[model samples]
Target: MTVDPSLSEEIIARAQSYPGIRAGIARLKDVLKAPSYQVVPEGEWSTSLSVLQESTVPEWPPEARSVLVLGLHHPKNDPRLDWWDRGNTNGNRRLMEISESLKQWLRKELHLGAYPLPYHVEWGGLFLKDAAVLAGLGIIGKSNLLLHPEWGPQIRLRSILIEGDLQPNEPIEGFFPCETCDVLCHKVCPQNAFSSGAYRRPSCIAQIDSNVANKVPGGEIDENGNSILVIKYCRACELACPAGK
Candidate 1:
């Protein structure tokens, strides 16, 4: 079936209609050439229980023409959104639900093929921060987080691959939030991830490893009144940033 030429607007509008969601589009070809794709993915124990595993590569669909990137703001007040439990975070689960709903809507109403991508780059997922930036959602700040205009670096991202072509959003220009700042985000890191003037991914991963070692009980309780232990990942750099406050 031929795709609706005006489907991009509808898709973005429908996605943003959900509370606290911000959406944008990027051409699959452009996203393939994104900076993140140029580098090799690291094999580490950041979230997955496996330690020092081989990097997982995604098998991109040959016919996919565009990507719809979604970002859900993670406020500091609601830290649970970023906590990991049973291998997933509440924020990521929320994004998955939203992506699934939008994918079904496109397939059923518009006769378009859409599939939600996974969250982990090791699990066949796109580098979401790269996709989000290409989709005009935000800029990658010094802390190595996507800095949205309104949410700064406090947003979680996900994406969907679409068989039909959609117009890519223009990336944000001249919006470097860290350019004039004192880099407080860097100073706040427990692992000194930015000590070398560039983000040391290994250092950051070490903190995540620590968070896993010191897991906390989640708010929800099971039928036995025993709550699952959730990993509260470190976000000192993200919280120290004054940008979206």
Candidate 2:
């Protein structure tokens, strides 16, 4: 069940070949024990969302040995990347399509078992930021978002579970993006989510709930020529960071 370094590199290269994508690998066990799991126990009722949904306790497959984490850059100029229609965002849908394509290639071309995970933890998905950190994709900044070296907080993540153990990427060394800065991200938070010196999920969720309540008319018109509604979630904290801009 072990994969050689060459094979691992190949998989990573394949993932990154997609537009605006960056990829890394991590041990499944390491990701399962990520710091987020310590703060919030699995199967608990999630309060971060406006909707009522219990967090799915991860019951990952026994054979899963490695995680292939994929990050998609969401630059500030393109606000549409994070726009929500129906139940998902355009960025998230693109990630899903990429993961599914990689999964099929893994099975058919490499004969490896790959499982593409969902975007929501309530829908049997892993904690993507945690996994991305463990995969050496980025570091969690003051914004409470995964900040890549080149993209800062303007990146979204998705992951695929691999049956074979792949070489794990190491976290960046001596790279602290938030130190000695004015922390403009915190100041820009409409909810002051970081006012307590740390990210408050409740405060953040309050803003998200408000966004859901005040959805705007989307560019696309419906059958009756009425514009469809879309939820544009708050990104003040994420966009204010000047680290990777």
Candidate 3:
């Protein structure tokens, strides 16, 4: 079914009226340019997009017609947010907070049903990059993260599918900024994660499998299969870009 134009306008108006919601969106934009976050669009990154659709919740609400995607900038300076620290929860806390706040505001102001999604692929949630693209946030970079025109690839994302036919936001069109720049992201990886050609889905799956199989409680793993808990940050590709910095 198509989104109801009037309903969408109403929702947009209401969303704009909420100071918290507006502030949160502003914070997201600010964080993207904070020298640490990146913005990748969704359409260009089909591999990640495919994975996300496959992971989305099997049964979405009948009324869930549009999605409101939110992003949190995770700059390299604050590397801890990307870490699977303690219970693998620290990195996701910001996402959780944004989702919760958005949901609360939507429910209170618009009387709409919203579902806060999870990050893991196994949990049936779509990729943040895909949602961001649909939400007109950014394009997906070769590095596999969402890249915004203003903020390269240093952002975290959260999304909620609304259970009402709302107007979908216009998407950013025909913007490819990474084409002329030298590929610096590939050069900066300490682990040379991008040394090979673009990531092959099968290869990545195999590597992740190997990682999970060898993972020991509270320890790290290197190529030799030793437990060290180093948790390498893979933002080399993101850091290599000169966009939002």
Q: Residue 27 in model 1: shift from native, Å?
A: 0.8
Write one digit per residue (lDDT tens) for candidate 1, span 43-73.
4643452532323436767777899999999
Per-residue lDDT for 203-236 in model 3, tens only? Answer: 3444444444453434446579866452333455
**Candidate with the larger TM-score of 1 and 2:** 2
Cα RMSD for candidate 2?
3.3
lDDT winner between 1 and 3, please give it: 1
lDDT of 2 by residue, 72-180 (tens): 9999888898998766788988998899899999999999888887667767677899999988888999888998999998999988898867888888777688996
Superposed model 2: Cα runs more than 4 Å off: 1-3, 41-59
Q: lDDT at 95 for candidate 2? A: 90
Task: Give the Cα RMSD of candidate 1.
Answer: 3.5
Clashes of each: 0, 0, 22
The TM-score ranking, best first, is 2, 1, 3
Model 1: lDDT of residue 83:
88
